[model samples]
Target: MPKPRGRGTSAEPRRTVKASSGSARARRQGKAGERAGAKAGPPAALRDRQERAPASSRARPRKAKAATSLAETAVVKRPAAPEKRAAAERPAAPKGRPPRARAGDQASAAPPKRRPRNAKAKSGADDAELSPPRPPELDWDDTPSESAEEVLAQRWAARGEELFQQLEGHGAALHEYRADLKEGRFVWIAPNGRVSAEASARLLCSWSCATSVLVMAWADPLVSGAEIERIDGMPAEQDGVDEQGAWQIAMRAADACNAAYLYRVSSPQAWYFLALDGLTFSPKRTSFHPGAPVGLVLRAIGEVREAIASRAEPADVVRDRISALSDSLFHQARYAYRDTDWVARLDRTGSCLSHLAKRIPRAGFSAIAAGQRIDEWLERELALELINALSLIEDEWSLFG
Candidate 1:
């Protein structure tokens, strides 16, 4: 400011020289202090602190220094005891995190502590928490399999078998008699005319008595008065006995007898008979005669006797008989009655028999049970009439002397 300083001149040259000398002296003193410190070693307080420190803490610098030396020498050194103890004492890192490694101690580090295998929760407990509960087991027993009707039928069949065994004991004689009658070898002459042998008359009388017993046992109590009168008034010569009239007469007598027999049979027995009839008997077109009813009665008696002798269940047998009776009646009615009033009566009787034949065992014994037995006197009188008729025959030549 006093006078502009010249470009190459200084106002304090001597001062600048003095500052240079001072800086050189300061540098020389610092060097001498460093050399003295090297000879004397560290201060007493610092050395004492280093000696008192834990081995784990004290080995840190030594390890660093060794690492530097190894780098310089291109060789590796084993970790010191202090470094190993420090690594062993360190806590294991938490799961999902890596342990922090020292700057130059990566190789000296201990293996990461494995989580204790037994320390984890039990596998069963974990599964219980994650899965749904199990279902209970089922019991298949105690379940009903059959319908009520089926159970009833089975019981009825059992009962029927028991009854059949009881009835079989009385059938042997009847079957033998029926076989004898079927031969049709006997002949008859008018009463007071040329007579057959006494033995033949006795045999014929016996057959007539057997046939009457069966017919009386089987006769329906509901027989129409008109039908009874017609039968009672019939002429011995059969003047009106054409195919149609013969059918009507035979069917009327047979159906009445069949109805009575069915009434006497048990429900189970009846049902069994019906099933048998369905299997064995079907409708057929055929001729009818005065002797047709007798033939049918004999056939039925033979079967009944056979069944009784064999101790066979009667349900099937009875059912078949009823069906046969009904079917026979039907064929006769169709052949004999066309659209006449007798057709209706025949149809009704046939329907009654058909119902009996088709009945199941749902009602037990009450379904087909018979009412009271026929009056004893009436039965006796009918038996007497049959015997008398057999003794006289139209041609009384067959009568015993």
Candidate 2:
């Protein structure tokens, strides 16, 4: 501004002057502080106080702070004792139990005290007294106790007695056969003393003669008064006029009767009567006119009659009889004339007999009640089938005649 001083020279001189003034002011302040310190030398009390104090306290507060921090770090780094840690971690005791002694304090430990049994019972009684009383209940002291096996045996014995009574009744009916025969009936004697007219005297005689021949094939018995007459009355031998001829005539007589009448009169009981009559009357004469086919049929009919007469006979026996009857019918059918309507009728009758025989074996007889129904059905069906087969035989005989 004054003369546009030289750029580098003027700026350097001003800097130099400022630096010198700052150095001089600094040195003066330093001297003044030193002098003031020398003039106020340490107070006597402060000097004594300083001497009495610890040498460590005389050091910087930062150094003392660092020393204290090192001590705290050592304390923090140290681990707590196991016993103290366990004590701190242990759970508080429940209100009901006393405080438990430590496991390590075995000397202080004792067995836990228990209330006496009588005291416990008294407490229970007290509690019951506080509660409402229960209602009275029935006592079963008077009831008789039975063991399982004993009860089972008793039940079986009772059932056996009942079954025996039923069997006796059935046997009584069978035993009445003699009386029925005396009244001119084979199965049952009606209250009115009327007998089925389906079995005429001549037809019965012919059937008796045929049955006698069958019986004689198996066993020979002594001939009697009526037996002699029946044998003498038999016709002379001729073509198509033998035991088979007698059977055909008897079958024709059966066909002439009502279906119900035929079924009733041609029952197993009636067959039994015929067998008994032949055995008692013409056993010797029957042996003379024996035929294998006729004997087989008669034997099967006898078995069926025996099964009906005796309730104790097992179902297998009845089944065997039915099977035999079917077999006999089949064999008889083979003798039918070929290319005739009778052949078809014989086949149908044989099929029905075979079906009935098979059905009898399949029928269940586990219980008496169930067996009774099955037996009834079998009896009815057997009577109907016998009637049908005999009717077919009669028709075949008529066609041939």
Candidate 3:
């Protein structure tokens, strides 16, 4: 084995002192020079190799060296917690919107935003007053274009002036007029080219009832630009169902017949119910469809459809609509579905028209009673219509039920 070099050996021309030891010794010397003014300063390590080094070779006094050296070699232990720091309480963060980016940027990299110069310094009801105003108009869907063909049954028209004269008193003495109409020779022509030369009075009455429903539709109307302003989130009409369209349909029928002339007679429908007091019966109409049961319920149904399609509307809004529709359409409105007798209500809707027909002539004695009866009849009719419409979409209950 080769011999190891001895400590402080000068046998060979090689350095014995380590580079790290020399650097540490130089650092100690520099520290001692910096602490020379202190009363407790220690003497420098003289008569060593450090004396040969150049004066300029001394390292500068460093705070890091002192702290590290004290930490490693000397330490004054601290308590588990500092008394002064524990005594002082830190303030909570301020509550407000975080800093926002400048215009053209919606990020948080920008500086904290300051309140507007005009912002109110105090908070209370005045804060609400300072808040941004909501828009006056709601975002409603566009009304659909009217189609050339209508979605409803055929418009009511007389065969001739003779038929008009025969049923001139149909609104008053509907029964006598029906008897007269029953005795007459008639030919029924359907839109699909079907001919019924021997159509029964039952068929005629059913058709007439359906036609009267068209009158009901005309009296109330459906989705129109004016109506849209009042109805929030309603689907556009699929055909001629709105005000102008309904007027056109009614006018076309009026041109072909004289059904509107009956209002001139003393009847239940002539005053306060369908016709307004002091209004000319000449193409008489109502602008307030929300009051009309058929119109309101139909519009509410449209709103439900819109709620279903967009789903942006809250469930509570849709549920509220259902409750309102039930109140207007059904006899006994209840919030809970289980609480209602849906079957009886549905049956009442179909049979209420008969009760209405019976009550119309009797209404000659009491216009007030007649008005109430008409309201009831309208509710039933609306309910029946709603029932029919909902049947096709009942499966979508999870969305808008």
Among these predictions, the greatest TM-score belongs to 2
lDDT of 1 by residue, 277-308 (tens): 11101113122122223333333334433433
lDDT of each: 0.36, 0.40, 0.34
How many residue pairs in model 2 have overlapping backbones? 0
Flag regions of model 3 displaced more than 4 Å.
1-165, 168-245, 249-303, 311-324, 331-401
Candidate 1 has its poorest 10 consecutive residues by lDDT at: 198-207
Total residue pair clashes for candidate 1: 13
Q: Report how far residue 398 has shifted in candidate 3, in Å.
A: 15
TM-score of 2: 0.20
What are the per-model numbers of colliding residue pairs? 13, 0, 0
TM-score of 1: 0.17
- Model 1 segments more than 4 A misplaced: 1-313, 339-341, 361-401
Error of 2 at 50 (Å): 99
Per-candidate alpha-carbon RMSD to the true structure: 23.5, 27.0, 31.4
Residue pairs with backbone overlap in model 3:
none
lDDT of 3 at 270: 13
User: Top lDDT: which candidate number?
Assistant: 2
